[model samples]
Target: MNAGNTFEVEVRGIRREAETVRSFELWPLGAESAESAESGEAYELPPFEPGAHLDVHVPGDLVRQYSLTNPHERHRYVIGVNRDPASRGGSIRMHDAVTVGSRLTVSAPRNHFPLNEAAVHSVLVAGGIGITPLLAMVRRLCELGRSWDLYYCARTESRAAFLRELRELADTCPDGALHCVFDGVPGTAPLDIRAVLAKHGAQADFYCCGPTPLMDAFTAALADVPPERVHLEYFKAPEISTPANSQAFTVTLARQQKSFVIEPDRSILHVLQEHGVAVMCSCREGVCGTCETAVLAGEPDHRDRVLSPEERAANRTMMICVSRCKGDALTLDI
Candidate 1:
């Protein structure tokens, strides 16, 4: 991450939202200083829309993207982190080493999963930690007096983060409703996404963020829905098999007037980094939009989950971390 493009924040408070989930409240440096306390006023941070995320630079030299959970109008940014046993160090560090008053670097907000503010009604589906982004959407929708329904799925109620807050919000809004489904409970059945969609009707815009299985089910259920009416974001890249016939390709950096050869086994990102190229990158697995580079020429074999189908068809930009040139050579804006 670029130091000039990031902000320094202090952890103001932390709460255990669930057994494995911890929510951190962050305030900009000096926001909670004696001056603000004496003045009894709040200090504002950079504005962001709902569904935005921050590239938090954590210990172990790892950068992980976590969605903002609070309303966009807030003075502080809130993020919930879930301790994953299979984590590659980010979440574990957040849960174990981080604490109140710890200073952290975070990039300004970026939103690939923006809520459609114009939609008359919205349906939000969340699985486990996926609720982070959707919670912000619900808060924004409520503020706008828009109708929305949320379907929250978790292994059990005890494992659901922000469950009490969601329920409280639902009770405050007559136009909004909340549904919970715990599949791990003995008597409970898994959420029937198809049935849920059917009951909600086709006019409501749908949004989902969850594990691979839930994401797959939600996507399949919305196969007939219009692209603009469906929204989703992935916390990690799906397990996709790379094409067996990938061939060597040459990439030309238009601005730098430099060229490099990319092997079939190596990623474009790795090749660029090896050549001393500076690119802002986080999740190299193609889940984060950090390594997205403008495509000046040639068709790209898109592999990232961040871009929509329409965007992929346009071939205007490609995530260099996992995507590559379709032909023998390609040009990039660098």
Candidate 2:
């Protein structure tokens, strides 16, 4: 809150969370100075909900999104990143290039996957690096006195993140429980995803974030469940769509009272920002919601993974970063 959307943050500490994952403790410079003014310690971070994430700009001009792991803290942020061999230089940079004194630029917290306060029972399922968001959700559930259950799946104990915190939650939870299911551990039973999805009651909501295979399997297994009862978080864009099938279109910025042609090669976000439009955007691939603009008029081509099927059909808003115009001319509230 003390800095702009993108601000400089120093890596205060670093600890190896797993064989491949490392946790980074970042402190906002201004916030740290303000906190040290009185008690000499910055705590927590600007208020963020359970499933919030920050867009971190790493070396080599690569930007990656990582979820916040601590829901109880407000002044500082803790993010766990796994050294991905296939990374486009982001995860590898975090693991190998960054150190305690390294400084990085990060976007403010934003939540695409949020918690449902009305649910009496919450079923939190996480896999591998996907445990970041769900870890915060568990802390939030404990703080709110809500009943919940966690199905944490990992290949082995050495590859899992937040083991200590999970153990503490398992011991302290009143009505909920923790189920640690590992596949690499000898003589340990594998996690049954179908059984976990089937056991939850009607009032219980299912939330999961993990590898694509795990998420796809969960989607297929929970197909019979009500659509409203199931939720998911995706770091990767599901699919990219364009207006190529249709003719060229025009975009009218309602507030600016300006119009521009949307060509085949150029995207709406590109054209808008080029025209000096002050629209905030991150994850140019359209996974993050920084460039979500209101749809006051005309239909839009919904291609981003952030919006649900119902939201896309409603034509209320769209993520302009990757989405396009479907009609000849589209009007926006921008």
Candidate 3:
């Protein structure tokens, strides 16, 4: 609940989409009535593109980001949540405490995984709850009459969240395709990432969001593909290791006219917070792009999963939470 900007929404509906997954429909506080939505009345919620997510402020001061699954043109936002065995207070609270008509604060929609609408073709690969964001992309692509393919993977058929909706969508699109892979079923092997990429050829832009192992395999299989054509979103940050010979660096805040020494053991975020510098951050592991800062002058040793490889090479910005300066001195537009 510590975000800089947020608005209130009331839960209008909650439906169990799968065995362990539930879809929540949220509408702005004043326009929460079902009649308004049905009547085609104007509801003034902020517009969002596909692959956008909202930071939902749940009870107990916990904030979690969930991708929007509904069509981008809709007035309300829909998000799917899976009950994880490893409860982190957010998912458990959403399942046990939140009910219809509940009021919650959520950040405005922000997108880190954007669809390349101009690409010749789009290929979407999703696993489990990762289907949330890609579903929006599929809806948008259908609206635009674009060619696309979706490969939805899950542990079992019962675990797939929006299978029926996806099938209906595929049936309507003459050029779109949908493939479901349930690898955990008996006698079924995991989807071969290499074989899938080989079929798409050179014109397709690939998008993937899934568990760590699935994403890792997809990334490795597409190693030769141009960075611009490969888009990925991570649910959690991967393990990051610092170099053994890492050295301390100095950061100069341009606006504040201040300089601080960033120790090798401590992150730049921690040092800035200790000095009373206000920087909003969440998911300190670098999966969320909350602490992204402009780099006036410095080559950042990018360790964040949020940024693409092309962006890292540009060195125009850096995530303060886990990334560090490549050299001894750096300049930032604090």
Candidate 4:
């Protein structure tokens, strides 16, 4: 990791990976550069794992996240971003305001979807821009000489980022295992996730990141596989309609000897923060694991994407941002 939890970096390069996707290369500021403010001197970035991501501070006080596509590049972190029309000024602002020499403050790498090093085989699946983190994992697996294959899908060939690089990597492996599926290509068959997943044994480690529908299909396809062995990273939280049976509940902070009542309209995190409780949070929809809190004594309504079905059943922790107490009163360690 970096020496500090956060640092400032200058954008050094921008490369178009596809029609809408562009890669940003960040060069971390060094001592001399900090003093000069324009010097070319920069320090080697800290090491990051295959699935790690950095929280980037964009122009509108927005802390949007982007996955690091390359971990072995010592001097810079390369992240890909698609110019999303529906973005809340994050990706759009990055595309418009950021260029070579644009300075930005960023958090150190953090990973929730990590690669399992000891697996007998690995299956990497990606959809559109979701290929960023999986590309990093593919690079790591190739470096270790591990057996792995990637199934990448996009709406069209022009929108598929890193195709050339992935093709080259698969070329190094036997039988060229990179599978690309493009829906817009003439006579291209729809990718049957069931057929793709069935080719691999249940013991193989499966990793997927993509649009919600695609991920749901993957989850359904892996019903026979152990849930713990299947890893997923969601760019957006799964949509769940409000439960008509939802009720107001109370949360007790065991360590602080504090209690707060959460109305059905408000989340536990909102109530706690209103009462001056400190909790770091991101993606309030619960996809990111930032607001995960220890559940010391009560059953929590688990709603986060970070936890597995088994972890949810254990009730060890819950994401306070979107989850609530299952019982009348929930006890938290903090």
User: Number of the top candidate by lDDT?
Assistant: 1
Cα error, residue 124 of model 3, in Å, equals 0.9
Between prediction 1 and prediction 3, the one with superior TM-score is: 1
Write candidate 1's Cα lDDT for 1-334 as tens digits: 2333787788999999998999999887776653573343445566678888889999778999999987654457899999998978899999889999899989888888999999979999999999999999999888998999999999999999999999998999889999999999999999998998898855899999989999999999888888889998997888888798799999999999999999999999999999899999999988889888999999999999888889999999999999988899999998
Worst 10 residues of 4 by lDDT: 31-40
CA lDDT, every model vs. true structure: 0.89, 0.82, 0.88, 0.85
lDDT for residue 325 in candidate 4, whole number 0-100? 75
Candidate 3, residues 1-334, lDDT tens digits: the string is 1224787888989999998999999887667465675455456466688888888898888888899987554458899999887957788889888999899988878788998889899999999999999999999999899999999999999999999999998999987999999998998888888998999957899999999999999999999998889999999986657888678999999999999999999999999999999987777878878788999997888889888777888998899999988899889999
> Cα RMSD (Å) between model 2 and the true structure?
3.2
lDDT accuracy of residue 173 in candidate 4: 63
Clashing pairs in 1: none
Greater lDDT among 3 and 4 belongs to 3
lDDT winner between candidates 2 and 4: 4
Q: Output the TM-score of candidate 1.
A: 0.94
TM-scores of the models, in the order given: 0.94, 0.86, 0.92, 0.89
Candidate 4: tens digits of C-alpha lDDT, residues 1-334: 3544678888988999999999998877552333342333346566789998888888778888899998766677899999999867789989999998899988778788899978888988899899999999998888888889789999898999999999999998663379899977888976788887778865789999998888998989888888778999999988889787678888999999999899999999998989889987767888877677889888888778888787899999899998887779999989
Clashing pairs in 2: 43-75, 44-74, 44-75, 44-76, 45-74, 45-75, 45-76
Q: Quickly count the clashes in candidate 1.
A: 0
